[model samples]
Target: IAEQFVNTDLGGQLGDWLDFMKVMTLSSDRKAAQPDLENQRLAVQVMTIHQSKGLQFPIVILPFLQSGSFPSSLKKHPIINRLPSSWMNWEQDTETTFRDIHNREERRVFYVGVTRAERELYLFGPTSRQSMFTKELESENPQPMEIKTMNEHQDNSLSLSERKQRLLADLNREIAAKQIDNARNILDELEKADRGETADGSTPKSTSREMLHLSATKIETYDTCPLKYRLKHIDNVSERKTRATLEFGSIMHAVLEEFHGLKIAEQTEENLKYLLNKNWREDAFEYRLRGEEFRKQGEEILSDYFRFIQENPPNVLKRESPFSYVMDEINVKISGKIDRIDQDGDTLAIVDYKTSKKKEKAETNLQMALYTEAILRDAVPGVKGNPGKANLHFLRHGDDPLSSHQFSEQNLQDSRIKISKVADGIRSGSFEPDKNEFNCRYCDYKD
Candidate 1:
């Protein structure tokens, strides 16, 4: 109000009037005051409607029930409007008008607030300009009282003893009610404990809750932003619809998996093109023109990759190999899929496909180290040795894209320690967000 007063450039006369009003409000019956329950320190809880969700109170007061205040005017979604009806399954997923969606969400929030009162609910606003919701309720044939005047009291004010007595009576009633609720809650908890059940009425697991297996992808996500990892993994929050780049990567990986499954002689340019066309995502691209551009790029990339492979064919040992490595010392299990493994002389070479524009360094990359360690620990069949080399095969790079790194003992150990720290942090529920502006800009769970 003070800021608004300044912004509105209200003069000294208006300021003096505001000061008088403030004083009048403070002395009024509706003056803000906490309950005087010292022993229990009980007081009326004040919170937003959102915070009151799924919680029932004896009495709930909803203020600012005016139409403009409660159900504010709808905001436009410019991006959604500009998007194609079929792009990213928008129509199929929503199947409703944007205004309707907004109204439904607002209604749900209002319903939650209303239902939070177990016994009594009070709604305050200008009777002349009531909320649209009040009209909706009226349509249901509910009775509403319109008060014009209160019955004249014999005394305008109460004496000190009379006020004290009234306050004491109200306080005692509240205290008794609170005591009964607390006792009931205690009894319920004791009963659940005796039955060997959790507070949620489910049987408790014997194993430690901290025992969790993590994927290389999960560890990398946690390293980048712990909150993102928790929201996606622990809370099972759905990520934003896959962008063209991610969908492209997925489709490319699928095509390569099928292409490499065949013998070297069977892997020809014609066959590669066939596989690419077969596995191409039609709906992944936001625009048809962009899609065509990507398709042309994919064809060229596949052609170049096919030529490179034909010139120097790798001794493919296993393709799309799944492996799991358990570090018993830290009680951390690492699981991931290696894109390809090759028999490079005496030791095995771990190859992970990368579809991104940027190249990842194998030495410092925890994902590469994890795959190498797993293979070295005999996680993959017929492969039991240290990391001869780890290569990040960037599919975006048509010719000579393999970034290889031979990990020393210290590098591997450092990677392991880092992995352990990530595991410990996740187990301890330490999901603090990394507030890096660059990362947060593209983060789906930034909120």
Candidate 2:
């Protein structure tokens, strides 16, 4: 059956073979392609780590092990660093819960790879590489096999001792050259400074001061990439023109706010559409075709939104109507726009609206949570006998449906704790940029 399979047209098929003999024959073809395996070898299967999770291999060659490689140093930092203390704690707890799930999956893949080897298993990688698995191996086993270059593995390869000597000589030569160049540059710079040449031919005493009000966004940006934050916030680089999505969001926000402000009886689909047209910029639509698409999406969203509001208007008691409110300021120099402030008797509620895609796990966003804390402590006066509740309403992306989360006192306190830590980090200039692969993939600064 194996001989017939190898010679027949059926052997050139894709996918798994169910027949026992066919499976064994196919596996042999894969092994033959591998360098270490010759006769009786099977087909070589190549796949990414993610794809290879369930599969096992006789040999695994993980090349290019470096500081920024596997078990990446980037994973040390958390993604939601600027989260409010309460939310931060909650997120951390949730993260811990999920961490085990991820670790188990990783372990399963590793186990699959290890168990795959039948007769021989070879794990080859760079000698100078630093990976989590590599580190673990080094810790468990004091001695590790030295990695050799292709030339070193050749028939006429140099001895290990000779290779070391050659490498050392090359390093020494490079170091000597670098030292000489540095000494020459320093000497030239000192001579110029002594002769009043102003080093780079610029006045040294012409320093200027620029006020930079650091917000949560700015802090997060600085943490992601200091150079980016400096270029944008410090140097005041002009941002790219707003995209269609953002423009549409702004238009929707404005129209929605206006619609809510109107008398309940006065609300009409035709009037709302008219308001949308009036507010919409002629050039808002980048293209005529996009404009039509935008109109269609807008109409659907507005219709749904109108129906939602009509069905469920603000549920305040008749006596609780016209909730008078005043914005409080925190002396901490932190400033944020409170979207809507409503009062119910002695209690005040801070409401913020977010229009984003619905997340499966919608924990309180740290920034907004911090804002709530600020309002409770700095903005709302406990001494004046008027303390308010904080609520966040996230409107589903491209829809009118809302999901809300209320903040407790504990949540506010947690926000304060996270904020204090962030503030300390900022003051101490310890905000380090984290290069998380997930964030790097989408980050504007990533190159």
Candidate 3:
């Protein structure tokens, strides 16, 4: 739409038009165009206080209402706070402290949440002691209301195990104490329970299990921490965070995928820049500053990538190829999308892109091994025979970007064995948390 408008009104000024569009999209006026969800459906809606702004519902249930958790203590960003005020152009307000600002925002959020309930508003918190805001809200009402316990209406179809009961108790305790991380962990435990997972790292005797399905990410995640893998892949509990690096990597992958689809003659640095410009997402990053920083980094990486591709134009056979291979021994199916594949002489070459900080070795990389084996087994259409080479194209590494290695029969056999072992563990429900510090550092379920 911007392109069409630019062509018609601005005489084909695409770059300027793109800048204008971005500015307008980021402006506060964009919220006016948001679809009203109040009358859209007759189902119960679950949303955050921010999402509930300017919208009302028939019933609003505000769960996990605790002092520190709901209002959230005034916490400053370590890096941002340490930076000079002059550098950030921050103006210090002598009258208002950081805590004041935090309190005001929290109060506004609570107010919005309270007003969202048209007919009934259910506020849940600790029975022993309530949140500071809860006192203020209750004081306004001043009248006694009927109370109910959570376990009054139990479903006949569902059975609450002792572990689940303990988890529920723990969730209540954590919320009362305003232990946010502990509450999240308990919530994950409850989700696992709902999915028929036992607390003792064993599958239920009554439940029938299916054949294990594996992907490169699944294998790697299981290897990193089985509990994390089970929570993410099995129970489908995603980590809630707007990671700038992941967002940048996704944009890079999308742009490169589209760029590689073009003819070799059409693949130029200018075209690559145009692709980046076209696909750049401002909302993906948590902060606008970080987004701008990544945008600059993207241009540099793409410039290097464009030069490298021009110098050694690959015989590209396929782009973003999806393949599924079944392991006969373990009866486990492994599936993933290969970034690119090149016809290297008599054999095929599997190319996988990476935006990781560290370059990966093809010999040790399970993804490369899996992709190579899949192609060799004729699992991927239009590709056959043993892989001549496996390439890990590290986009972040300006120097020594490509890591190429040829897989031996022994390496392939070992990978299969590894897969078999992982499958066996998963099949038996061995999702015991790996408590390694390195593995737990950036884990979503970390407490």
Candidate 4:
């Protein structure tokens, strides 16, 4: 592409346009178009699936026609399964009765996408056993013009000419890679200033790392995949982006904290909304519209929580309180924020807000248990020696909350022991990745 630009009659103009595009991409948070594209003829438009709705196009190119890419994965949630009143009049199919709406919705969305193309619809789906879209495209029962991938070479799927072309391309790529490597080696040799004192210069410092503080998230991350933890904590290679889910969680946390921290008289819906507005991070989402949707969800969740608390309040004690406990015996310390702490007479209750429909297991939740350990270790003012109750307030469930299982002093003690062992392993450079295909979707270290 660059070669074509340089070889063109308007070489200087093309080069300037490319340089301007590069500057725009670097200066902006996302990729941006050239300013002069508006003045140019034969304009092309690019947009997301949601943005393409109700708009017709002469030609449409749908790339990455995979299972999740088309309709996305639908999680099993309590509210999502319950159908609304409008679907009652439709034929009572298996999808309407059982858990098949996920697939049905996927097909419907794809149909809408295809219908938008009046003349041509190009579906570029890769051939994979796991991709349901690709399998259907490969089948005979097809009205859509399925453009078979030109890269198909296995099992005599390609013509002789195509195979020859592919082989030539591969050979050329190999040669180019070798030439680049040789050039780099030559440049490195030329750049070398010192030939060394005797033989092979001074040896580099020994590669050894030190262990730092440990937390529940750290332990859980390490347990999930050691490579993931090392990539995040050690290498600092994160897939950080404007994430809607993470941003929503943070927004809800702030709203809840403000709701509980204020006095009972001041704890109004308006006041809570004010706190949400104050803490609303618009830049944390890829799109401003998505951030608005998250705001709406947060508002509803907060309203439900505020109403529930008014009816069933538990003498709100603390909100968004930071706590740290040192274990010199294990040479480790745990630090975390307690979402909420409730006082029930002499006993105190630990509460954590969960955004997802799924609940964190009590046995594995080192957060509250670790907090309880601090109270047990020393004489806390409000809390008794034993924590009376622990609750997981799942926000997605509306008013419903999942009660935590019974946790004991032994649980807390053993948790510390586990942390100590993990810390020691980390110090000794024990980083073994737990390879599970199930987690590759979420693992940043996989690629």
Best by TM-score: 3
All candidates: CA RMSD (Å): 21.6, 24.9, 19.8, 16.3
The regions of model 1 sitting more than 4 angstroms off are: 1-209, 285-287, 382-386
How big is the positional error of residue 394 in model 1, measured in Å on the Cα after superposition?
A: 0.9
Candidate lDDT scores, in order, read 0.71, 0.51, 0.76, 0.64
TM-score of 1: 0.53
Per residue, candidate 4 scores C-alpha lDDT tens digits across 86-162 of 66666654435333677777777777777789887777753331235435443444444432333322333123233
lDDT for position 70 in model 1: 68
Between candidates 2 and 4, the lDDT winner = 4
- Give candidate 2's TM-score: 0.44
Q: What lDDT score goes with residue 256 in model 3?
A: 90
Per-residue alpha-carbon lDDT of candidate 1 for residues 1-447, written as tens digits (9 for 90 to 100): 333333333232344557755876787766655556764314588888888777788888888776566676687665754665445555357667656677788788889998898888776654434565654664455434432221244232221133233333343444556776655565666566444345688754433555579887888899999878866675455565435687787878888889889887898889999999898865556445557888988887788788778787888888888888788888888888888888888888888888888876777788888888887788976666656789988877876788899877788899888888888787766777899899888887665
Model 3, 1-447: lDDT tens per residue? 443343344332336566767766786465435456776657677689999888878888888766677788777676764544334554753565567778898988899998998898888764323455776654356342433223334432124556675676667667877999999988988988876766654566422246668898899898888888877776555564445677788899899999988987898899999999999976565334566899999999999898787778888888888899788777788999888988888878888889888866788999999998888888887766667899999998866789999999999999998888788778777888899878888776784
Candidate 4 stretches greater than 4 Å from native: 1-211, 240-242, 379-386
Give TM-scores for every candidate, taking all chains together and pairing residue i with residue i: 0.53, 0.44, 0.58, 0.53
lDDT of 1 at 217: 84
Model 4 scores what on Cα lDDT? Answer: 0.64
Clashes of 4: 0
